[model samples]
Target chain A: MKNNTKIRKSHGSGGQQSHDLLENVFIPHFRNSYLSDLEDSAVLEGWNGNIAFTTDSYVVDPLQFPGGDIGKLAVSGTINDLAVRGAKPLYLTAGFILEEGLEISVLDNIVRSMAETSKQSGVKIVAGDTKVVSRGSADKLFINTAGIGSVPENLKLGAKYIEPGDEIIINGNIGDHGLAVLLAREDFGLITDIESDVNPLSSLIRKVLDADVKLHAMRDPTRGGLASTLNEIAQLRSVDMYIDEDHIPISDTVESVCQLLGLDPFSIANEGKALFFVAPDDCGRLLQILGSQPLGVHAARIGTVRAGNGQVVLNTRIGGNRLIDMPLGELLPRIC
Target chain B: MKAEIQKIVDEIHTECGEEPIRLMEVCGTHTMAIHRYGLRSMLPSNLQLVSGPGCPVCVTPIHFIDAVLQLATRDDTVICTFGDLIRVPGSSASLESEKMNGHQVRVVYSPVDALRMAIRDKHLHYIFIGVGFETTAPAVAAVIEMARENKVTNFSVACAHKTMPEALKRLAADRQIQIQGLICPGHVSAIIGIQAYEWLAKHHNIACVVSGFDPGDILVSVLMLCRQIKRNECVAGIQYDRVVKAIGNTKALALMHRVFEPCDSEWRGLGMIPASGLAIKSGFRRFDALYRFPVKVKKSPTPSGCICGDILKGIKTPLQCGLFAKECRPDSPIGACMVSSEGTCAAFFKYQVVKSCA
Candidate 1:
């Protein structure tokens, strides 16, 4: 294997430099039999029953962050998307657009993270692509992952299956991923060791399937955070959402950071958490089961579905009610 | 605390009785908290909660945004601004749109971040869009001080800061709204002091209660306002006793006074009011964008029929505007009030989800 320590513009020239990167960097880490074919696409046996397909692009700044790098985020985000739909992620394809002058060591670490995350999540990186542009053309690095997963025929889930009386539950706290990443940027000069909650949720989700707690709907709140996720669910189901403020789990650190920055924790992003809608009867048992797991320890029943037009409301801890609307514009640093 | 809040809420509901008690919350953050707590839905129908000129982003005049846009278009300048300012439309263009069209606009977390950027990169001029109410002016003033101490020659600030008490006084005197009381801002009150609102109460004969951000604090303040009105008494009080003081933060006020002085500033809704906006003092004129960058902010025509000014003055609600929920939205906010996340129009559009059934 050749030791290329840096990615030059020629690395994406589709010439000897590109070949060197593929052989030395990509192949050894993701040397599946099908991937080794070096064909245009990897040929694989399709799932027996149903399949789930998802594509996500990761463009988080400061390629490497506290808990994970862009590579880990890319892989985990795809798998989480698949897992929330009751699908077992089987194969993922990674595409990297690296900026010129990025050290190969950084790429190597990211690649290693992606490989390890894929293996741990029971998925294979069967195919991948890499491109390097001028330093000004892109940020340090951006990764896009497309995953193909197998959905068991017995598993049927969507907003249509969600009922008005169904209970909404979150795996853990909100705003960790966003706040972690924000602090990692060090733009605000705030120093905190809050790691990004960027982990694949396939295992914990599979546990729910095994428990058979009658989960109706699930979503991994990513970009717009939990507010957008619940809003999507509410709009899709055409039902009102009542989220209890006291029940929603938020760490003291995340809460304080949000308060200082005037950001709503509910509106901030979460990468590793899953929001589940289940029947009220099974919600308690499901919460207990989720609480038993590590990721779900802070798991809680946050809200209830009501029969009305699509609306998301937060029942404040002070016994008042307020609308939890979609995030608008941007979360500016506010003093008041 | 919960029971006490409930007790107050119950009493306010009973006392406010059929006549439709109109109270205006005069802070952007209060508007957000009111919506976040779903307080509007929980309040009695007879009690109408109106928004005032408290949202700095909503109340910012069109010319201020236009001035910032001109500075952004300059190749020699790196425009630093808060998140909401980037999206706010200025006549034909916005900072966000300008950025997309290849202008250099950096969305910063705070004025301190802008100061840092100016210090780090001396190759380009940095102009921070200092836009906010008194609650934020002190921080911007601090940045100006930092810029001076560091001798950051290329750093300057475009001031569009508003004063809260003056706006509230004008809001109270407006005959169209008929607002019975004012739920004053907690943070602004902390800086300007709870005593700052005494003039508003004394002169306008309106009940003013500086309240905290919590739902309970707001509910209790509303109840206090109801009690004041019930007794036909006009007085000022502070519900946020822990954070706010009678005389305000003297140190911050001193810094603000040292860096800036009151100037007749134009507001998007309220028009030109005396001593209602901050302008960098002549001694610090070199750090002021209006003085350093002489850009003629041509009186660009305001968005036709945009009721942002009316909404900010509490003369009209977002729903009263014809474009609301149809043409005016947070994503493509046609009115200044719809631009900020805390803007009354954006709040109404987003929270009014359950309004149809309610």
Candidate 2:
């Protein structure tokens, strides 16, 4: 009703147009035997276990960015949430709020991205609903993903398992995803080729779980980067965290941007990375194992946990110590 | 380079003889760099590095913030400010809290963004809370020129701009702080030139060394200061020669001079100092928020449990403050020095992260 492929209000009116969009676009892209039924609720044919259910919304301003898009982000974010809880991701339900007058090509690209990501991650988009709001009432598009994953009876990972002498490990470099997104915004005249490190980390987590190393606590540093994640772990586990500035791996490009912008690389968010709290002896083995993989080539043991209430300290390269405080206000709004 | 710095520090430690050397770093970045690199641990027990009132946010009086918060509440006004200023507390509330209360306060990375925002919303009064030293002033002045050229009537600046030379001069005159040498500001030197420290060097007989915001640069500058003091040579030295010139950025000076003139200004800890603050000149008076808005700033009151005044004046360290770490923290800062990233208390809390009593 709008352009050749532009979206309109009627498309979300729960009429013939909505049916046509589902049958033509959503159905063909995310087609599976279970998804083809087009029922109100998705019935996973034979799924029963301790299911880990989580939901996250994506509304990044520049919907498309280098290394990933809003679609990929929506999938990756929810997938990582499940993966961190020691679960093998199973199915995802995507709900979209489309702004009227959006180009069908843009929606097409987002949908295609979602479908590709889902297929690659071995998850089926079993159900979805779309709603179109009037122009100015909504941004270009907003995607909400609700995912459910299954956890084995023996597989248990959380703060309760963490000990004082455990080691803090990261998959890759810090501050890449947040910095890449910022550079992609093209604000402040900063230009960098840094791409968003947004990826579904389920495969790598599974590989690590398959290994002999004991992962006490596992989490993805999504919103607040390494600092926030460590702070949360410390608060939950009733311990102190001390990381050496020299040990924390940071790229030269990311460091330069942080220097220019007065932003801390540790405090910046990471989309594709995960933090693992492992025993001191197992830290070396875990690092070697994670480093061998493509998703975690730069894995390193960054810090050590100590017996304290709740504090994260950074042992400075110059030989002093500083507290890594939880960022109070929004470091970068709409970052996730 | 690290070993060479260690050697220099050793030589300076030996050169100190009996009395300890108290050198003050006047820039906030230098304070941060020293802590970030853990330079304090590397320094000799005889040499003590202190913080001066160089941080613009740390030294900005409470009334200025109260005035800005008042302006933010107005229906027809929009407040444009740098990110850090939003968190700095006034008497009752801050711009960050006001924003959460549905005020139109925008955090801009650069002053140009605020100017552009002002031009875009012509119907609304846009007040940019200008807070910085000479390094940022020239850039803000350049954008003011653009605003004037385009005749952006809505744009005005609540200027809290200050100069480093006057503040440094006042510190040299103060006796209690015990400053034997000086580590000058790198970014401010890039604007006002290395020659700006000549007066303090000649009159006060203090060895002033300009430094870049890096561990090596700061160490090299400290070593230079130590050697100068050892040799009894009170002069201005430039160690950050790559970015800062001997004479300084002349074109930037011209732009700054064209937009602002010297006036008596009130520093947070230091009382009213003459010719320290900059006011928009008559040519650019139209962009002055002081003239446009009837700013009723309350009588500035010292923060209840903060000794940031003495901390900025080099008389007291963050550890010396009663409320530090216990009550005054980054999340709920009791003073301006704890709010800004580069402030002395913030640098101490962030890098030291230790209980003073312990």
Candidate 3:
């Protein structure tokens, strides 16, 4: 099995020296049972249970931005996806596609970030793979992660169960991640203090799921933002959502940046936030539970689900209403 | 808030009844706000609010688009533009369609992106399609400053920018279009100041109200314009008092004057308005694309059966076009006015104005 692991790591390495380092250092450092003999796979033997599986890719431009890097991005993205499904993340498998001639120091920093983030999220990085392509073939580095979690027996979470009159709540302000990336890119030469809230949410989610409140469905507003995610829920449940624009939590810096760029914060991407659809009776308790945690410090109830034919509308601050249509195309392409 | 706006609308209707008053909002932002907020539905049927050629993309001439397209097709040239200008159709094709044909065209959020690209790619020549009004013109001018300071000779700009007050004067002078008042743009007013439109108000007897992009702002501006028209008063009124000041941003205007000088510019519909466009001054002419490339473009005629010219002049609507929504959908635009989201035709098409009117 050790020899097989070597072969698999070499094959996944695609001729990069980092694969050799991972196999030599990281693999040998971990216990033998955690080491998988298969390529990009981890084997475990324990009590049987239903497993929650989720995968995500990080392709944020510049590879680095204010407050986080792609390594932190990969871990948080997958963990959040698993947490919203009412699962407790146990392990994560990371796959790296490194561009040829990339700096070894940059790769080392990214790997270190992944390790730190895994520790913070209380998950073990049991298996990983690396591949290198020709220079310019890949944009710096791309990280793909697959996570496995154990779902609690009593937890029932899905869009199908979302009922009318349910309350919609968000963990924190939207557009922080998008604005941080934009400010770091300096694409418009504007300066702001907004930073990406790219953090692991497994601990926070575990706390929320452990509470007595009933959560019908939970999703992190990532790529297409709060508006697009709400639209997805609306369509899935065949219901309508009415969100108050003024009630949505947006920082002053984010608001100013969006105003200047002609962007809607609701449509901007967010990384370290979750949207919870809870029973109307449980909203106050859920808010109390979330507010107790650091991750959900800015949590607020933004809207409610109404009986309609699957559409999302916003009651704007100006006392007028506008449809929050599905995003036509990538609002900010290459943003994780 | 709804009742307050409704009351203002009622006052406007009472004042403008039985009069065929055509009020035009000469700002792309205003055009978007009107459609996005459904403000057209609140106005009286007889009081027509037409969209003017305030959209820089809609008014940019075909020769400018052709020149950018030509540059984009080059082996070592890349064209950078704002998102709105990519799909605007020129005489033959748009920059977006040209890009699909293997040309290098990038959509940038700002002019600084073009400057950054020029600095990053030493081999490729970068030509920024400078197409906007005063609000954007200053930013492009700032890019020129950065390029010069960094000694980045690979970057040049194809300036197709126009001024607002000059176009407003042209629209007012034209007897064919009966425009009673104007809703001026808040952003442009923030740069050029409210004093820029003094001539238009004094001679044309047109009330100009600088308005914001909110529903309440538009409603209040409309009421102000109606009040002025009813009393035979002509002046520049400002409703967006928060962001727009009387003198405007002097620092931005100073940077603009340092890099560019006013020249006679050709509009797509309104042709050859004097001192309407900005050109790189003699000292800054090294960054001018026209001087560097020296390409002679054969003036192509506007597409037949397309009334974009009249539509932009506020003399016609998108419904007047035979191919407004049938052929000029947002995905497949046939003219500049339908290509940009802020364009009159695009704002109408996106909001399904035709169906709403029916």
Question: Superposing all C-alpha atoms, what RMSD in Å does each candidate have to the true structure?
Answer: 3.4, 3.4, 5.3
Candidate 1, residues A1-336: lDDT per residue as tens digits? 333577899999999999888888888887788778899998888667798999989888778778888888999999999999999889999999999988898888889898899988879999988999998898778888999998888777987899999999999988888887778765677887677888999999999988999899899988778888888888887999988888999988898898788788888888899999999999989998899998899999998999977888877777766677778655522100
Residue A200 in model 3: shift from native, Å? Answer: 2.8
- What local lDDT does model 2 show for residue B97? 93
lDDT of each: 0.85, 0.86, 0.82
lDDT of 2 by residue, A160-268 (tens): 8989899999988889888887878757777677888999999998888989588898989988888788889889878899888878988999999998888888789
Which 10-residue span in candidate 1 chain A carries the lowest summed lDDT? A327-336
Q: For model 2, what is the alpha-carbon lDDT of residue A125?
A: 89
Pairs in clash, predicted candidate 3: none
Q: What is the TM-score of chain A in candidate 3?
A: 0.91
Fnat values, one per model, are: 0.73, 0.59, 0.16
On TM-score, the leading prediction is 1
Instruction: Note the DockQ of each predicted structure.
Output: 0.51, 0.40, 0.15
Better of 1 and 3 by DockQ: 1
Chain A TM-score values, per prediction: 0.95, 0.97, 0.91
Which candidate order results from sorting by TM-score in descending order? Answer: 1, 2, 3
**Residues forming the 10-long window of minimal summed lDDT in candidate 2 chain B:** B349-358
lDDT (10s digit) by residue, model 3, range B200-232? 789989888889888888988988988888888
